[model samples]
Target chain A: MRSNTFKTLLLGAVFLGAGAVAASAGTLDDVKAKGFVQCGVNGAGLAGFGAPDDAGNWKGLDVDACRAVAAAVFGDPSKVKYTGLSAKERFTALQSKEIDMLARNSTNTMSRDTQLGITFTGVNYYDGQGFMVKKALGVSSAKDLNGASVCVQSGTTTELNLADYFKSNGMTFNAVVFEKQEEADAAYDAGRCDAYTTDASGLYSIRLKMTNPDDSIVLPEIISKEPLGPAVRQGDDQWESIVRWSHYAMLIAEEFGVTQANVDEMKSSENPEVQRLLGVGEGVDFGTPIGLTKDWAYNIIKGVGNYGESFERNVGEGSPLKIARGLNALWTKGGLQYAPPIR
Target chain B: MTLRDKTADETPRSWVRAVLYDATIRGWVFQGLVLLALILFAVWVVHNTAANLRAANIPFGFDFLNMRAGFDISQKPIDYTLDSSHAQAFKVGLLNTIIVSVLGIILATIIGFVVGISRLSRNWLLARAATVYIETLRNVPLLLQLLFWYKAVLSVLPGPRQGYVLPFSANLSNRGLTMPRPIPGEGFEIVMWSVPVAVALAWAIARWAKNRQAATGQSFPVFRASLGIVVGLPVVLFVVLGAPLSFEIPELKGFNFAGGMVVHPELIAMLLGISLYTATFIAETVRAGILAVSTGQSEAAFSLGLRPRQTMRLIVVPQAMRVIIPPLTSQYLNLTKNSSLALAIGYPDLVAVFAGSTLNITGHAIEVIAITMAVYLALSLITAALMNWFNARVALVER
Candidate 1:
């Protein structure tokens, strides 16, 4: 009688464990069944980062990141919908499953990763706190901003960084803060502040919106490290791997000198690395474990272009933003991007 | 059936019928049913919120209040740093909200009373002008007014490079209005303490003068005497203490002012928006209250040899106040609640700092929002209680 009851309890425990596994295993299948991936993008039109075009089609580096993930999963970059979100609403929207993933320009931090029920895939952009001042101000360095009034957007880490930078340097400054990024931009344009502070990428974005873009100059100092990346809800490891590898596929494609124009030609190359990345090797099915097509990385490169191509097209020298690849280069090229071998 | 002998064998109504027809029992039954429904609904909401939070793995707790608020509040009314706890940040926000609302209330009352009386003035242009002001101000949305003030009006001002210099060595720029801040010297504290004592002495002397007038039919210049004691005593004390005060004038050092008090543009914009918007409603209340008082009281005072000012002061004002206080108290509450709009302009009010930035940072929405609502509710109740007390003091005491 005692043995029988113990067996029954063991059976109950097994069922509960299976139920927990089943609950988290469906996010990938759910996205596929829904026929489109829902991606959260910045709503306030950060120029080269995430903004909708005149035809209402989303465009930018962040938007392209979402499209690349969709391409990897569904073999079609267009199988994605964009939801514009503000800084305050992005994480909650992700946690609530209101969106499948967030590709907005969000900085990955320790607390957010562990506490907010979200996982950072990888750094899509290496950003840092920087200041932009009117060229006429003749302030060459951030340290020269002593006693200057700076306009900043409230509810962001940039505010804390600004305070720390100034305080550590033994200088005092004033912050003229606003709720919206556009408000801060407009205030800066109207000369309500001596400098406007945000991420370096954001400084470039705002400069494009300025009345006289040439009249302003971004300062040289980077006060804080902001590793902006994509994030997804933290429960399903399958979904996280899919998002993480989608970005890695692009990075590996860039390292192999593959572009959208040459991906078809590279498919026939004898290089083992290229063949494996394109999923054309014996007993090679890297995508099936992640519940994606075998040619997932190939589809991403073909449909969304490689990482270097996306960067140049959206925010780098090929685009109007003209931002150089400072620290975003590959590990082989003296930068931080290093992806694991596809084999 | 109509007379008396038709129902000799009639029995009492059934218990169900009797109870249904009983007003007191019916009332209690319905009330209990409603109370049960409300309780169930509240429980369902709390349960659903907890379930959702658990499913999302978002921890629901107030431990976030102890976390470091890694942000800077530019307009903090108290000492705060980036290392400050979220609880201290909340206190700073609450203090700012109180300061702006109290200042807005005082300014709105003065403007409202002036505009209200002018609307009832005998001069045609003055009345019409006041009427136009009320219509325009009341009809416009307060948010739009705030945006207009912050963006269009203040932002368009010249930069600090060409700050508009004003008299008394003050400066006005898009940053703010910068002026001299007064610093109290050695004996200024003593002089400050004397003013309150002078006010109390003045009150006692006024009471004595009133009693003397009533008992001996002798007139005394009570108003002048009280005014002299209140104003003159402070001045004499200051002079006797060798005028222990100094002014620190603001100077244009770098990008903005230094060495003085700075009234930020956000504060000015919110103050202007809230006061101007609320004054129109208060003006209408005042006008209606004054109009509700019968004109006969005014004529009766005049016939009793009272001047126009005396009739207004002694007879009309007291009755008008009884009608005004209730709605006026609500107006004060509305103004306080409306000050939350300071968030839109980054005024660092309670809602902006605590409910907004803190909630966003910590991700504990339910707790933060509940605390904010409770604070506003408590403030409204306290204001209502105080106003009710003042209302009772002015109420008619009939023999």
Candidate 2:
């Protein structure tokens, strides 16, 4: 079974390799013809990130990003089919055209951006590698975990960062790796290791699944920068622009205070930037250039809401994860999330 | 004219007739055509793969093995770190696979033989229990059994601080089973050296005993003497060398046991799962083999004044072994291959380390997976070769 599964995956990769080089030229047309945008997402439940609910609906920041693209393309947020993939399968799924866009909580690394034949549209969630330890361990900082055993998901940036951080600090530690997030969580919960390391946002998400959530505490140190986002196959500039602008539209919507409820009311505002954003007296037909309707941004805002609203609803104070906005806040609010002017 | 000319004249047959009616020509033509088709198919797959890899910008080379793995593996048989080369990580994974499959093969064979005999036993409850074991375990999938053992059984064990103590100063917990590690001290080499010498001496004694029995019609207790010498020699060497082996007992540490031999729960769970699962099939093979032996042979031996145990061992077993061997060889190979399932439970087997985590990190999926498949093929071939040799040795000698 193992060999057969591996052979099938290898064969899929081979067939994808040939098709990817040809590069699906009319990806936007293909999505339209299919009547739904196939979006890749994290199959495992990472709370506030992409995860399925009891009713099998995908909900989170990344899911909202996929929905935003759907709204821009079809003018309906529900016009999407989500393909749940692991970190290892995400890129291949995108390259193979098994998925139109990948909105999984995947980091936008340089190698992935250039080498994997895919382009990350924009940073959906800025995260960093961090450690979550038992409170009784009394380890407040990552530096204190000198000889500790760390439970980590293999095949992730978190594993590499954990190794680098410990080596640079001259600490020898043991790493207990698991293939999946749930396995790692089970190991950590069963006390197989001293600490569990992943993205800080992931730590909070995982903590909610723990038997004793209050007994765990995330360490203060952030070891590595992880700007995770949605990605699409490269070489399709039209589709890339649409996916890229879907995120930019959300950010711009947030900048203009275009809440989903008031987006229609704000359509008649006197503000030039807001008017231009809504495609109402625009200097350039931004929507036409990106191959979408004039009210594409407005449609996105109405369907999936702005960046701040999605963040609040998914990972912020409005959700159970309750993660602070931190670096994900708008530039005016002293954060790194800055979108270009709509004009 | 056709029959007369074919026999009398040395004329070449027509291409169509030769290919259609000629046995030698027809077989070669068919084989050649099939080979050509196979080659064409292989070429197509390769061309597609190469083009795809080039398009994906993922270089199709094995140079990635030289790069650092940048990941941690828990069960390190040899010294390995995150800084180790991908090649080294592969070696660690291969070693772990060998360790589990080898241990699993030995344990499964023992269990299989015992259970197989019990199934044929006259004792009603024992036979029923053996039958139940064979039926239940063989029917379920191996992967589910591995998960049941790892998650349902091993994962439910208490943590390190509240570990379950076992006999012989061992401890069991979610972390693993920690036992005493025998560290070889000064003069330990002498005891190792004495083992081969003891075996040689035992062989000579056994040969001499067989000769004495043939000559005097009185058998010597050669087995007892050989056993004593083989075991006693190692003990005498150890004592003379001032008992040069110290036990490194596992002590409870911050989060786990420290300074001892730790059999990872992953390994234990995988070993148990694979061995138990394979043993069921092996038991059926043994039972069928034993049943194949004619009862008349056993009765004949008993009529010759041989005891029931002797009749079974000397008459029935030798005949039954021939039937049992070929299928048993396949079961052993299956167990070795199934050990790759350890990847699912995070046991860091060859597939997990190489095709899985290493491939994910390096993005050299094709090369890593190819290597992993090749390794399993090689492992299976080697096992088959060994088992075939054993089968040959145990087969009845013909004049």
DockQ per candidate, 2 decimals: 0.24, 0.51
**Looking at candidate 1, what is the lDDT of residue B370?**
74
What are the per-residue Cα lDDT tens digits for candidate 2 across A246-269?
Answer: 998888889988899999899889
RMSD of each: 7.9, 2.6
Model 1 residue runs over 4 Å out of place are: A1-25, A281-283, B1-44, B152-156, B209-221, B395-399
- lDDT assessment of candidate 2: 0.85
Q: After superposition, how far is residue B259 of candidate 1 from its true place, in Å?
A: 2.1
TM-score of each: 0.89, 0.94
Q: Which candidate number has the best DockQ?
A: 2
DockQ of 2: 0.51
Measured with C-alpha atoms, the lDDT of residue A89 in candidate 2 is 69
TM-score of the A chain in candidate 1: the value is 0.91
- Per-residue accuracy of model 1 over A1-343 as CA lDDT, tens digit each: 1121233233223322322232254678889899999999987888777899889888888888899889998999999999887675677667766689998888888878887778999999999999999999889999999998888876677877888899899888887766668777887888878899999999988998899999999999999999999999887889999999999999999999988999999988799889989988777679998888889999999998998899898898988889988898888988888899998
